[model samples]
Target: MIWQPLLLSLKLGVIVTAVMLVITLPLAALFTRVRRRWLALVESFATLPMVLPPTVVGFYLLIAFAPTSPWGAWLERTIGLRLAFSFPGIVLASCIASLPFMLQSLKSGMQGLDSRLWEASYSLGKGRVETLLRVILPNMRPALFSGMILTFAHTLGEFGVVLMVGGSIPGQTKTISVALFERVEALDFAVAHRYALVMVVISYTAVLALNLLQRVQLERRS
Candidate 1:
């Protein structure tokens, strides 16, 4: 029983993290490079989820992804997909909720590097895309690694958005966090505790490992 939820959470986190990295890559690059007036607005939008309660975002997702809204209708029409009370809904919710961590990490990583490196690369004949792929991305390994682990852990613990958008469809959308709550609600405290303990240990171990890796990488760089 716990295995189902545990595996579901791992699946969700991995898929969400992959999509987030790809989708947010260009946005993060543009964000870190641009000298635009709207940078603050975009930054604020990404950071809003971090500050707001997950329930607040979930409530809006319910509305925004519901058939009543044109945006949702258009999405459904285009992709032949429904968003409400579905696994896709949970994925969408988690993606939105976890975006800031990835974006901030990537942005900070890009910004922290010496700008002259980009300039030098560009001057030497590397195109923007090439330089980004070969240089910027390599340099951002630490942030990218940390951000991925953080997002995975956060998604594993996500509750409110999953509850709001994804009904606990036992084999489909029942992530560990949601499953744990259901167990508690049914007064199955023992099982819930076990699930919780596993999650805590996994998360702690991942962060500790990532920190040590970051330290080693930093030392090598210095």
Candidate 2:
């Protein structure tokens, strides 16, 4: 029972981190190049997840996934996919809740990049995509790792949004955090302690590794 929820949380974290990397990379690069006015709006929108309460985001997502809504109706009619109280729904909610962490990290990395490197890549006849791949990405390894770690960690501990969007369906939407809550509600203190300890250790280790990596990266650069 404990292993099931732990595995589910791990799976969700991996999927969410992978998806976030794909979506945030190019978006962060775009933000780095855009003018200040547009960049401000984009940053605000991207960072809204961090600013807004998780329940608020979950509430709007619930509305969007309600059967009466156009999106929900269309999804059900066309693909037979339901977002409310589903595994995929929780994944989507986790992605949104954790978006700002990945985006902000990558964006900060991009912004901190030396402009001369971009100029040099262009002068060497590399196109934008080529330069981004060969020059920018290689230099942003620290940020990439940091973003992935934070996103994965955040998703693993997600509770409010997951509860609102996925409920506590065992083996489907019941991740470790949900399981922990359930265990506590059932007054299973021993099991809840185990789950909480595991989460705390995992989260702490990931952050510690990220910090050490960043320090090494800085030392290498200097």
Q: Whose TM-score is greatest here?
A: 2
The residue-by-residue lDDT of candidate 2 on 1-222, one tens digit each, is 889999999999999999999999888888888667867887798799898888888889888987789999999899999999999999988998999999999998998889899899999999998998889999988888999999999999988899888999999999999999999999999999999999999999998989898899889989
Residue-level lDDT for 2 in candidate 2: 85
Candidate 1 backbone collisions, by pair: none
| Residues 134-197, model 1: lDDT tens digits | 9899988888898888888888889998888887998778989998999999999999999999
Report the number of the highest-lDDT candidate: 2
Clashes of 2: 0
Error of 1 at 121 (Å): 1.5
Q: Give the least accurate 10-residue stretch of model 2, judged by summed lDDT.
A: 34-43
Regions of model 2 farther than 4 Å from truth? none
lDDT of 1 at 187: 99
* Residue 208 displacement (Å), model 2: 1.0
